[model samples]
Target chain A: MSEFKQADHKLLVIPGPIEFSDPVLLANATPGTAHTSPAFIPVFGESLKLLRKVLESTEESGSQPILIAGSGTLGWDAVGVNLVQRGDEVVVLNTGYFGDSFAECLEIYGAKVNQVKAEVGDIPSDDAIIKALSSKPKVITITHVDTSTGVLSPAAHIASLVKKHSPDTLIVLDAVCSVASEEIKFDEWGLDVVISATQKGLGVPPGLSVVLASKRAVEVSEKLTPQGYYISWKKWIPIMKNYEAGKPSYFATPPVQLVYALNTSLKSITSKPISERVEAHKAASKYVKDELSAIGLDFVPKNRDIAANGMTAVRFPQGLKAPDVLPKLAERDIVVAAGLHKAIVTEYFRIGHMGVTAVDRQRGDLEKVINGIKEVLGKNKD
Target chain B: MSEFKQADHKLLVIPGPIEFSDPVLLANATPGTAHTSPAFIPVFGESLKLLRKVLESTEESGSQPILIAGSGTLGWDAVGVNLVQRGDEVVVLNTGYFGDSFAECLEIYGAKVNQVKAEVGDIPSDDAIIKALSSKPKVITITHVDTSTGVLSPAAHIASLVKKHSPDTLIVLDAVCSVASEEIKFDEWGLDVVISATQKGLGVPPGLSVVLASKRAVEVSEKLTPQGYYISWKKWIPIMKNYEAGKPSYFATPPVQLVYALNTSLKSITSKPISERVEAHKAASKYVKDELSAIGLDFVPKNRDIAANGMTAVRFPQGLKAPDVLPKLAERDIVVAAGLHKAIVTEYFRIGHMGVTAVDRQRGDLEKVINGIKEVLGKNKD
Candidate 1:
């Protein structure tokens, strides 16, 4: 704890760009290193290898990890451009704001999208998804954990359903908010693609779009005429293969410092069994949810089982609003997110507990959050 | 000098991901800050304002600076998707590798690209450009400095020619290798768009696609249906405007740390007159060219006037190749890039003198590069 010498600032308890470890921050400060230099190549290669371990995917399963310099939204573009051709059928399992946006993105790229949308704070019903799947969509996208609503969809069940019904359909998981905080068995769950970014559970600065593609996904991409220049899988696949083989390659210049920071965070995350990390998040979530429940708060997700472990979306107490609680939290040096999901935009707010805040209990970050909320609510009651 | 406490490593003299200053690297190490946090809003806002100052663009002229989380290649995608609709006629003035690639990118997005080609290490002839413009292309693209061959095209001249030949044609400058290192008066030159990245003349780690678009470009983009999701001007324009107004807004997440580093570098770069920085690059380019010439080496560019001010592409002396010179320089803890142009790949190499290397004389970076080159060439002669 003493080694954490970062300048004093308010705790960033937002869903992403979460608190980073000291080592990760220092790694981000790496001196300028050429993307193709021998020294930087292995850093990139190891990061790729470690990503496989984190997702429980393997080269043996023909899963490839891609790290590009962009936001996670770019991951949606990669899917829309590389996987879906003009007028191809795609089923988007709409959980929250991200689902709507992903569907819109696929539509822009000419995908004929059928979105299965539930009411806000809930996942689409299995019956609706099966109905959408019966159309034999070319791809089905699921948001593992939608940050906007803190709804954790049952990914494995959906993947199993997809395999049983539309066996040839690709299963794409938007794991931007779930990857390091939740249990993701990419190969075991039969996920064809998992799209993510570095800032959330990965505990790095926000710059990289981290993605994994199955062999079938890559093969389908190869058959298509490249629609976008920067997001083309055909160009990036060779570069990823070369870097992972301990050789220097280039499609475009990578963000050198961000990759270094990602490598450092991956090492720390993979140091322990990923299951242990997921369990730690579960513990933190329980702690936070139980405390908030005691304060008479209702959550955005319909039930405990559906809520995300890394983040919580809590509705303001009846008669209280963002102005009343959020400002008080800010005064306490804590920062949480205002609610998204246009259906209930002003009803709730979000707090993120992932990475060091959840896994490193010595930091007592969750306690700070719970106490700050309690104090704010206590004053409101007065 | 005492304030520079970065870890000891080989100097990065490549054209991009060049040596960053201590302040910029340290800023990159900033603790996690949310993209929309009050603390970060000003950093992002100031960076946008500073970018206009660096480019000599003003809000009054309706020029906008866009900073996104991607490489310079993404800038090409933005132009292709935003400005070029299906069957749009565009002219690419091919100087080197980047020109061909930019044309390829534009074509992928449905532009009918007409490329005006020149021989290796030379800009396109005015007559060829005029001929291409006779088609009344929608846009004319120029690589301000093609990193592949170190050829610095006369961007102002081309923009003026485009205006004369086809008044409605947009002028796009790919300044990936020339932004802060060269003179660019966006309004004065009537450039509709200038595409760049942070790693090169900006002296920051690679991750950001920094672009500037004129009012006409924005208005033109708004008229077209967005072709790409992540690079959409319609989506980003509001976000950029909101941030510049010191307000928190989001389209996709910005790279918070990279934006911080970019702000640090931009503040430093704009501290003095931009002309002074350009002249420094000029002085460094002349010094390197003179030293190499004295050592009996020629350059890829046809003459000194047309060569890039930030980097030099020098041909190996008789019987010398990259293998004979680059590895020797690497041994001296100096790193440079091998030649990239396919036509003269084995005959030359590129050395970057930008940012701190070109501007901070106390660092003696250029002297070290020249001395190392002289030693490597002398050993080859012996």
Candidate 2:
């Protein structure tokens, strides 16, 4: 299955732009193919089908997956411009940087966005979400895992609460960091929309933004005229449906090479059980957390249950900053991300354990990260 | 410099997503690099410097180039949301499909758009543009080369006229199909914005929307707080400034691998003089156009001067259609695009001869396309 070997480089343990698998990286180097060709049609069609599988949904489930030539952040603009009409109220559950950005994006479309912020390492409580819903919002957005803090919200739990309290309100989850690694029961949890990207947990290189929405969300999108030509569902839905039907269509030129890469990555991901993939991420997260614990490093997230399985955000010990640790880690050929929270930008670091870095244990990327962190902290400890 | 070898596949002669070179394709398979790493910061900073070189502008000219993770279409939104305010009056020089799309994008941001359209395969006359400018628009958009009909507008001439008529109006050029292959004197022509993408004359892949704006345009953007977070220049300018200054700053996670590919392509392009590259493309375009003339295939563009050097949009012979010609070309392992102008979508086809297909004559991609077209047309001609 692994026909290509990845180029040798530093172990990328950053939150994303993660270590791409050999197949995924090589697929991106595919020869130029027409967006409308018969060869490219099946690749895109099969990719759409596999996206449903990765999200644990089926044709009968009335869900649609959208793949666009953009980053995870553009998915926010797509959701904002399409679903939330001007002057609509949206409750943003701000766990970290992504939540704040989403709320900002929604407001750009003239929506009144009220954010329910959590403590530095925690997600908003269920009571706070319920309280926010009493205002009768048009939509409620949640970040499944905030990349900045490595905090995984209880999405299924909050989704249940929205269904009960705000039956008409939509529930959108920014799963940019959580999609392939976390369990997202779309239909079971009554999710209205899920926003993600290929780079994070899908094992694909960074580019395409992936969005999935339920039947209700689709129904809502069909009725509203969005503000921008590029972000309008009125424009993209037909193109996506045409591609899924094994025909060529265009609202704008699709990124043909990235689609090939996504297809290869999706095939590799679906070739194994989805349950196995999540378990693999879980196990690796545990190993990294245990390793960090053994090194006397405390995590940003208050508890392990709330920590994201795809990545870990750990605080630097006293007297050491991002430079002392990050540069030293780079010297050891391991790369990680610095803190992103606006309040404590330089206090912590993030290490990703998603995709091939976690599943392909034979690659030993996790071991390299552990050793690199150990060596750095050992020398720099106060 | 050509150390890598690309795989053999069908020659792509579509308008964009043209055939990639050995080094360009290999640069895409790069291992994961952190967006903020010291190793990556210089690559991005240098790319910014080279972007100015290709545009024939100097750093002292107060022109800034934007690199974002999206398609060429997103470049329209970037200009729309950042430069044009709501309820602003704008004039769009309509040449083909892209003209209509950019007008629509501007309208989405609440601009009152006036379009001056020419007949199919032709661009608007200065008389028509000046007549439309009587409305005193806040901005005027011109497509440098509309991919739909392969019609290259006289952008510099129009900008000069607009300056004489409405000096306050911003001049935005959609250069998605023209950028590197065509001459754009940003500083000398007093152009405001040029919107482009990587997959075109820049010779990178299809992600990364590249937008360049003048200092005057920057002043206008700063004076207004636009809607939308993702496309906000207020948010992006600082991030771009940071990247160019060799600091790791983030508005969003860029497509790291694609940027690596772009860095390589830009190095290859700027290694030689811009005049040399444009001359090569013009020479190749003249060859292809002359060869098409010998076969009695007429182009959609009305005149040679108005025709784009990057691609040729040719009307099929009387007895042939897209199915008859395109598939036959594909059977010969050559691929081209069908007509994109809505009125004549089935009557013509496009052949791209930009980037490697235009410059790297040793690759024989242009020869393959010419021979394949000749074979297909020779068999199907009435």
Candidate 3:
């Protein structure tokens, strides 16, 4: 019996909460240490430092990093509560479901949202963002990579546009699915706030949310306040400052084991050039797309350049529901996600290729998925 | 030399994030698994079932349990967002820091808070809570064990009072520090909402917040229009229903590795006689208090009956800050928490003796703490 049953066995090939590395998984399972214990601080500090490197941020040398205990969705609330005051106009560059979620959160805080919607598989152009910023919104929110549609936004270009057209507007980028999969240049690209998660590209289990902010984001946050207490940035900064001085403090009890797993995963990333890891994701994504092309299926995103290296959204054959195809794939031990947006859920399903997924063993899993999909379709065809 | 130099070698003797079993630690450190995988659901479902058993709540058998990505603090917000509405009158039974935090979260959601403050070392009497509930508040919040002062409130008594005085007022119990250490009959005690954490009594890392709500609490939450999204109880119930039916869904990515660790920990707790674990905690706490009395030091909560078995709060001798005695204890490979509340930071320190700490070996460490305190006080007096 092995003390457990295999009827519960599932292989996740979905967008986020991807498979974890053995060491990382073991690290996650480790018992927790006190947040302020000498054993925990170094690991916590090291995790923050490595995150700064992963995001390529200016925050490493100057600004403090705030790690909150929630989903990446909390980042939208944090930014809105900390920087967007009542009646403040915010421009949202919408690429997928996450962009709409961000806009909704901002609207809840009484911020007027002006959205520039990008096509399903395409990122918003710099010209569109520049035009939107002509009205001088206080903040410009961009989705670096939208997990919902498997699209990667042109964050660097949008950041440049914001800097050139509206210098005072803060640029917040959602890098939840992109941080480990794609190249994020926070300092070079002038990103004010870069949001990430433990799942997805980081290869850790979900639970903790990482928000890396520039000095400008912190400075702007001080000028705003919201009724919400749990997602308050002002409440987190002082503790983070204490952390920078080598003392760990908590606004809430943190997910200690998750952070430990993240530390191990972050260290693994730093062991070699991070770009190589990003390229591995790129190569796996390309290999899957090549297979998809051979299967006579088309990718949801028409533009190859805008498609994220971490995940791919493909339109299933006409008349077959994406939901129906998911369970069929599951029968073969593969897990894939249905499209998030209501507009496309029936037409498309997403395949995630992130974290330790590009390795030889995982590549074999990907190959299994490719062959498995073809087999299922062959069996279903009349 | 290790890649990281400062290793945490001290035993955690604070109220929470206590020492865990080696097996539990090892289980937590094991690599991650996807939460939605067929393998994860059975474990997750079994863990939920076992959790209800630990709580002695038959009413919670089929009621949905949501494991959110955060500490126990998130539990308060979850309750507030899901059940509280603007202009609702809420009664707070405050004994320590966490009680105040709960009140703060409720007030933010526009609830009118009426606080019934209990003395530092005393649990509020049923008469006092009845008096507070005279206004017919919508919800009544109390902590089962306040980590700040090591006080265990008469939660069942308070719940009984609420039922008598204001049946409509839902009784919410913060069991963050007491769940595994003390005997709690959630259904028998008439507790509407029981909030607990993975670190303290559960013996897992601090990442996932486990909440068990009664049928009445869920009914009240269904009436609420979801004050916010991520903390929405409405969104969770349907998904939980779907998951229990064999189709798992997630609002945000859960920490997969932490879930694995929690699963193992939950198994251990329910596998053995539940009374044995509770008795171990009580015996360890008695030993700590007896040692403190033998050393001529006074305990923080004077009344032994109202004190929590998970931790012992002690008064630091005059001429020394709690911080001063902490380093000496740390030097002896033991860790204790300095005073937390603004009102008592200089005069107190907390020693946690929960989780695996109930075993015999912990007594040696407890003795070391007593000696460390004696030496520090003697040196400072000279």
RMSD of each candidate relative to the true structure: 1.7, 2.3, 4.2
By TM-score: ranked, best first: 1, 2, 3
| Worst 10 contiguous positions by lDDT, candidate 3 chain A | A1-10
Mind giving the per-residue lDDT tens digits that candidate 2 earns over B73-144?
A: 998998888888878999999999989989888888888999899999887887899898887888999999
**Clashing residue pairs in candidate 2, if any?**
none
**Least lDDT summed over 10 consecutive residues: which range in candidate 3 chain B?**
B1-10
> Which has the better DockQ: candidate 2, or candidate 3?
2
lDDT (10s digit) by residue, model 1, range B240-324: 9999999989889999989989999999999999999999999999998898888788899999879999999999888988998
Candidate 3 iRMSD, 1 decimal: 4.1
What lDDT tens digits, residue by residue, belong to model 3 across residues A1-382? 1112134445668888787776776566454478886677777878878888888764444655778788887777777767877799999999998888889878877789999998777777778887899999999998888888888887877788888899989888888888888988888888888888878888887888889888878887776655467777777778766665679686787677777888999999888888888888889999989888877888877778888888999989877886668888888888888778767877889888888776445348688778778887783342
For candidate 3, the per-residue lDDT at B152 reads 85
Worst 10 residues of 2 chain B by lDDT: B1-10
- For model 1 the local lDDT of residue B330 reads 91
Error of 2 at A5 (Å): 8.8
**Candidate 3 segments exceeding 4 Å error:** A1-11, A60-63, A124-131, A317-333, A359-382, B1-9, B60-64, B125-127, B272-276, B317-324, B359-382
- Model 2 lDDT at residue B18: 87
Error of 2 at B209 (Å): 0.4
**Full-model lDDT, candidate 2:** 0.87
Q: What lDDT does the true structure give each of the candidates? A: 0.92, 0.87, 0.78
